[model samples]
Target: MLRWLRQLFNTSPLEFDESWRPELVSGFQHWSLLSQAELDRMEMLVTRFMATIDWEAANGFELTEQIKVLIAAQASMLLLGLDLDGYDDVTSVIVHPANVRLRGNRPSGGGTFSSAPIVISGQAHYQGPVLLSWAAARRGARFPEHGHNVVYHEFAHRLDMLDGVTDGTPPLEDAAAMARWTAVCTAAYDEVRAQGSPVLRPYAGTNPAEFFAVATEVFFNQPHELCEHEPALYGELRSFYGQDPAARISRPRRHHQHG
Candidate 1:
């Protein structure tokens, strides 16, 4: 079905519905932070993402336009500075009513795996679908200051997987940039694993893959805090993502004061 849809969409592109603007405004906190040009691009990306991906609802959950728009908007935020091809590995999006539970062997640090039942808000697979919880997605989109966005986290994993490796380092522009990213991220990862980070949560220490995702959340959601705590790490992310969310987030406030 997805392949067929993709083929069909190839013939004619999906149109962005102007009506979804309200959903974007209400469902996503970052909506207001975007410049006019960025908002236009975001709408285009959101329409492409929603139309191309095969969406599914689990646990008898009913999917709605609001939910889809909310999720797509957040996912598109990551690509606001990059090309849409960053998420090419993501073929589908499966949304559950709440956290997903599965009993299996999972990563538990120390290069070891633990066989236990774990519940997660979201999961990203290699060359596969992205699974998310609608409840968590809604909360994250509406409350980005919490610095945890499942859509950002999972889609970030997809971005990291674009280079065919999920070692936390996404495709860099050159060897020089790659070396810098390695140095900065490695130092931060070591700190998180040993002493811990105030901006990054404990889960980031689980692995480099997770460290990237959690850092992505902080980079966008809590840009100022992350920038203040880890300037080099934040610089690496800003350079890689081609976005300075701290400035975008602060521009509005500076305007309101004079207005």
Candidate 2:
């Protein structure tokens, strides 16, 4: 009876395809930087993500395995040191062939909106599906040095929303960590709004939520630049995300660039 019950309760993890390894290594620049253990963990997350999320292709775009894996791998990277439940609210992922154009009220600036046909690469809705442009996602994965990844940006918004708020700050370990995060992020956000930053792009200054998402893009893509220019922000992100990307990446410093 005990053996029968054991078999009844048995379960298996999702299988990861070996063929996807090359696709990931070739498409994602950061794939080569992960340790063996981290790689194993990432594979687990990737498989689960690809299997769990409801993936859709807009405009009759062909949704291939390559697209799913590439997007899943990047999304999983964010949860490397965190729990998968952080994304429990995300039920679907919609991919567009290119930039999404919407003729609706869009945020202009300073707490206002304009009814213009705005083109966006990605968008994250609170407790809703994430929208991504395949062109932007593919470019961001293959060329991370540009410091603008739609997947990272949208998923970071999802993380920020996990606390039931769309503000820049995500859930922290404790009050002390939250305090430090606020201080650091506020300072950086203010600087970006005022004098502007070399590492962070102008779009980051749009709002606190966008700032966090944009910073996440730079934190992973241009770790060296962020570590060098905005050490405090980088340190806060490193502690919060539980990953020191600067240590994993080894590249000579170059002039700051944005995507």
Candidate 3:
């Protein structure tokens, strides 16, 4: 069905074209999470974002361009530093107006000090499928002077799983980089759990998975603060992502906030 839709879209002349795409990708109303370069990367990630998503008009939900920008921005931000190579692993994203219902009696990490089981709000499986709620996605993108990005949170799982395990470690640039990332992230995560104040967000301490996602949010939306407060983590991230977003956020914006 997706291939059919792609062929049909390619055959159509009335849909969005690539020439004017970069101009429309922004989340000015609720997101200050992307740089012009980052946004352009998003344009590259999803100029055909709509093309890849299983676009549909569902009842009780209004999927707006703003929403598309929000999701694409978050997803693109994930790969702003490294080459986003494994995205074809998940060819479709299923979105609902709100959290979708996981199947009944689904257990979460059963037994061995993890037997508290129940359905989760959002899940990205190892089989290359992503699921999200429109409301969850919107709330996540609001950047409410807090940290928590649902899109990045779930998609981080996807990227981490590409190596055949969801252990919260994505493929790094080199072995040396991987060793350094683990060491630095572990130290930072432990520090945050021990004495670091909750400046970035609390979920960063939930686990390595949450740490990557939360780090991503702060890396983009609150770069200056992250840089100032968690210099080691910031430096490690600078090395990891290859993009200094804190530097980008510090520069002047050529465009004014129209709203």
Candidate 4:
């Protein structure tokens, strides 16, 4: 009975065709230059990713081919290690030109009409929807060295909220892991709030939810800096994420450069 019920609710991940344009970049060259076998693997990932999203169009991307690919790749990477790991709760992804126009300071508004610093490149609604600026996502993919990735930032929030709330806690696979994660993440959150300037980002100090998003940005962007500056916090992030970006930060990530 349980199996049948699960089957009834299961849907495939969100998958898009290979219609987007390509860019020539050394760092993210894999998206354009990966071998057929690798590309096939990426496609598989994309298919599983589709299961996680109920993709809707806001303002579709009008940017360069590279930007579109880059944004898709980052969103794909967030789902790399898990099955059915796309933004399952989200039914749509609204892509805009840049920092979306603000309707007000309300956090409840959807992406199509919102204002900001309004330098937000991406934002995750509490209900599991996402809004990303194609320009910011492309820029982050082009330059992953800096500590700013709108894709990672926003997607991380979605992941964190999977536990039924948009708190810093995401779904942990085990109690032991959850305990360690809580300890470390809480410590990091407190430190960031107290110091005003954190190893991850000042924005993380904005709130617990923002801390998760900002930490994700640093995790994918300034990994080594995060490790060097805040080794304890970095260790926690590494433990929770099950990936070590610092290792790749030092060397070129040919095998895992899709994100």
lDDT per residue for candidate 2 within 1-259, as digits (tens), equals: 1434333323345678888988999999889999999999998888777766778899999999999999999999999988552366776899999999889787787788999798899989998899999999999999887788999999999999989998999999899999999999999999999989999998898889999999999999888899888999999999988899988966644655743
Estimated TM-score for each candidate: 0.92, 0.92, 0.73, 0.74
Predictions ranked by lDDT, top down?
Answer: 2, 1, 4, 3
Between prediction 2 and prediction 4, the one with superior lDDT is 2
- Clash totals for all models, in order? 0, 0, 2, 12
Candidate 2 colliding pairs, count? 0
Q: Candidate 3 lDDT, tens digit per residue, 1-259?
A: 4667665654553344454344233333233445666555555665545555554434556766656656765676667667662265665666677766544344333333334344444667676567777777666665434455677778878777778876657777788988888887898788767765445565577777767767766665566667777887788777767878666554422211110
Over 36-131, each residue of candidate 4 has an lDDT whose tens digit, in order, gives 554665666655444334444455545444444556667766665445444656656677877775546545334444344345567787774688
Pairs in steric clash, model 1:
none
lDDT for each residue of candidate 1 in 2-120, tens digit (9 for 90 to 100): 57767676567568898899988988999998999998888888888877788899988999988999999999999988855336557789999999888888877678899989899
- Against the reference, the lDDT scores of all candidates come to 0.87, 0.87, 0.63, 0.64
What's the C-alpha lDDT at position 185 in model 4? Answer: 77
Off by over 4 Å in 4: 1-41, 47-68, 105-119, 251-259
